[model samples]
Target: MKIRAYRSYFIQELESIFGEDEAESFFYLILEEKHQLKRIDLALQIDLTFSENEIKVWNVILEQLKQEIPVQYILGNTSFYGLDFEVNKNVLIPRPETEELVDWIIKSNTKDSFSKNIKILDIGTGSGCIAISLAKNVANAQVFAIDVAENALATAEKNAQNNKVEVAFWNRNILETYDLEEQFDIIVSNPPYVRNLEKEEIKKNVLDNEPHLALFVEDNDALIFYKKIAELAQKNLSENGQLYFEINQYLGKEMIGLLEKMNFKNIELRKDIYGNDRMIFANR
Candidate 1:
């Protein structure tokens, strides 16, 4: 079958679930990921053909898409901070905003002086995106990741190996922990910050598919992870160490306030490309 005709059919089929523009993008995303064919290649080479077997496989993916599954989950992997990470129902898919958070940590810590290496810890390190990215980028840095879910830790371990970076993975619920046992020069997390009240604001794909344990908290305790992690940072970070988090955009002020109450100095709340108060960095 010619790829164009199938692409058009896919677009129309998904138009009801997503709008026309989104459906178009989603179709091309699948095509690119599955076929390794660029949009320009498909457009310029109108004679491109997909085997019947290929169409059958794509149909299954299309069905998943129609059900509002995230394309990254359907693909079973995603790119995060320039590395490929295996993603599944067991772990949250890495997001571009989280990439920005990783970039912030990398750039912020690169300017510091260390004795040939820096010790870093990533709290709630689902999929090991932040931890692995930091390990891969920060040469000679020792990175550690902690997660409560055994399955999540397994996935993150696989990601660490796939990325060819050695990260120490630990199983621990960050909320219940008082110490990390070792002081870190930098601590980072993209932990659960979404509030229960904000569930409706999330898209259907995320609300229905992603791990809620990594996404939400009670509205009254919106900074649950931030508070706990900040408390731990005060106890576990080395002198002049930095703590970073990808936070709830709406709770930037709240996060800063919590850090200040803990006597965290040099606290900085930074916005992402969308100008939302998306990341916070502080010093112990």
Candidate 2:
């Protein structure tokens, strides 16, 4: 089958469900994944074709996309913070907004600030994106990641190994743990902050397919993870240590108030690329 023709059909079938632009993105992402053909290559080689077996595989993926399954899950991996990560139903796909939080951490604490033994902890480290990215970019850093789901931890561990960075991955529920094994120079998390009430705003691709345990909080207790993680940071952070969070956009003011009431200093809330209040930083 001609790849060009299939691309048109693929985009046309999905354009209704996920507008033309997004449908085009889905088509190209699969193209690169399966054929190693970039959009430029497809344009140059106008006669590129997919083998019969390859077309069968693509048809399956196309049907799945019709159900709004995320393309990352269909491919079983994604790129985050310039590193590749494996994701499945067991772990939440890493987001670009979370990558911004990582960039902030890396920029602030480069090799200059990291001693031979600076410690960092990532709680609820789904897919190990943040922890592994730090371990890859930051020098002389010891990284640890913990998640409640053992399956998620397994995926994260594999990502760390694949990224060629050393990270100590643990299966621990952050909500149940009172204290960590040692103080860390940096503590970060992108825990479950999406409120149940906000489910209406979520796309079907996420609400239907992603792991809810790593995504939601009760509306009345929307700040549950932030409160607990801040408490843990208060106890487990070194002197002048930093705490970072990928926050709910609507709860920035509340997040600032939580850290302030906890006596965390130098609080700062930053917006994501989309101009939503999406990340927070504080010092203990």
Q: What lDDT would each prediction earn against the true structure? A: 0.89, 0.93
> Model 1 residue 177 lDDT?
91
lDDT of 1: 0.89
The sequence of per-residue lDDT tens digits that candidate 2 reaches over residues 1-284 is 78889989998999999999999998998888887899999899999898989989999999999998899999999999888899999999998999999999999988887557889999999899999999999888899999999999999989988989999988888889998979999999999999999999998889999999999999999999999999999899998999999999999999999999999999999999999999999999
Off by over 4 Å in 1: none
TM-scores for all candidates: the values are 0.96, 0.98
Model 1, position 109, has a per-residue lDDT of 60
**145-164, model 1: which lDDT tens digit per residue?**
99999999999999999989
Candidate 2: what lDDT? Answer: 0.93
